[model samples]
Target: MNPTASSGRSPWPYPGPRPGDDDPAGGGQTIADVGEFELIDLVTKGLTENDQVELGPGDDAAIVRTRDGRTLCSVDILIEGVHFRRDWSSAMDIGRKAVAVNVSDIEAMGARPIGIVMGFSAPGDLSLTWVRYFIQGVREECDRAGVSLIGGDITKARDITISVTILGDVGPEGPVLRSGARPGDLVALKGRVGWAAAGLAALSRGFRTPKAVVEAQQVPQPPYGAGLEAARAGATAMIDVSDGLLGDLGHIAQRSHVTIDVHRSALGMPEPIRAVGQATGIDPYVYLLTGGEDHALAATFPPGALPEGWTVIGTVGESSTPGSWAVTVDGRPWEGRQGYDHFH
Candidate 1:
């Protein structure tokens, strides 16, 4: 399925002359020319509120109500050359990705997202139309996740940077923490794991043929509903697969003071990822074990407590030594890099 089409909304819904068109007033204006308040107006125009929103944008602060008396919050930032490249993705894709990653954090905690506030900074030379398409992407993703775009700030900077903070409610069951896994828990996962990493490899080498994997990297489809379902089904611990599966699971192991062993036979590699591996001369398991940005959910549940849509991929065991390696594949330590490291 087309990830962009999942929202059932046009990727570019703005009705106007295309970017760089011959329009004298709006079409060719840059961020500097449009100014800050006008850009805010362009972004907030037509934004709708949900039942949780008490006060939407235009005020000093936006208000959101929490039904559970507890709010779950997560923040993530995407930088221009680091997290994305303009030549590689459309403005809409970047916008969707920015929201998707942040919200995945909310879901990992077994919470329902209520709203998002964004902080956008871009070079003054950036085109106004690009900003419009970016916000359109954000709106599409917000609709897909059933969250409100309450408010955000825009400013001038040297590079385009988007910072998003998502708020969610976990209800009476409370938030699921990474530290709850027990020795006998079954490790399960929902959503695709390695596709985005394969997509990144392909894009890095100037190949984009495998449309599925490529699009996965551009806009991840984070099985948003599965998190809540897993929580309801008695998940002991959970996390979103933003980092590689092993790396994120390592967090659970460290926090819960257990060791997790992933079964290689259980992790089936998709055709697109295998194809990418074959073309790039990289092992498919590398992507499966250490790939990041897929936003898949991984959790530990009691035996026979597996929920629908989740596949058992590993088992949790007691750690023999304190402060030791927390994750293993096929009962041994992984040989190379565990996952993405920002400063590595």
Candidate 2:
């Protein structure tokens, strides 16, 4: 049996990158036909993950420790055609995002990442160098987050898919869960919102966005270390905005049993995105409130938990049990669509 077992197998037994080879498949039976390991090895070719991890790849399982007795972990998956497409994103960009977003979630929890485990499924035709570059992307991102990648599985499939699971140490302090927000808690956010949606709009409509917007879609550089800062600064409850703001805040609301009111007055504005809204006839609020993949941190504070990069978005109120999941723009009952239903 392969060492990885159920996790999958290495696609290529040879080391990183084969010159003149230009595809993930290695020009043979499709990736699914080779199964998992071979395909993962093909894509993950490259420099080793950080040495911090106790067990790095190739085993029945990988191991990392949680000194605080609690482990803060989160997982996010990207489907080839749904979440991202190889056509728009390079292997490196995809790799970077796969790592960055996971770290962002760990940060949002008010913890620091200890290690990462990744699961990749792809076609057999991709090139070997592509895999190495992808790992490099993960390593570079892990370096930024002060974490190392322990290991993960590689598999062959009909399409490209990446699932990243991050493990974090809660330290002795926080794991600011969603249920901790209290009434009168101040709403705060780190990292810009709506930009990724704008970039997606630009791509979908073929609108040439400024470099910044396009970059937003390709690789999101969330405010690094901000989650721990927020935690240390005393964030009561926190969450990462992987979903739209209203949609994500609904999480805080449901967990904290409060109503969340978003202030439109404080929104970040620029001509290109506003112009994109006008051109595409899509509401900017939709982008601001419903867009996902921004991976920004949204947390609640008891009274004053303001950090340098944090912005006040709104407040936590009595539960919406009276029939309002969110507050209206004008402070009335927000009874519109609850936003983002993953199934449809």
lDDT of 1 by residue, 1-344 (tens): 22332235443333433322334344687888979999899889999988998988999999888985788888999999999987667778889999999889988998888999999999988887788778889999999998899999998889999999998888866588999999999999999899999998888887655878988998899998787888888999999998899999999999999999999889897999999899889999999999999999999999988998889999999888875547999999999988899999
- List the candidates' TM-scores in order: 0.92, 0.84
Q: Candidates' lDDT values, in order?
A: 0.87, 0.73
User: Per-residue CA lDDT of candidate 2, range 208-262, in tens?
Assistant: 3554665688788888788889999999899888877777888888777788777
- Name the weakest run of 10 consecutive residues (lDDT summed) in model 1: 12-21
Off by over 4 Å in 1: 1-26, 322-325
lDDT of 1 at 321: 88
The best candidate in terms of TM-score: 1
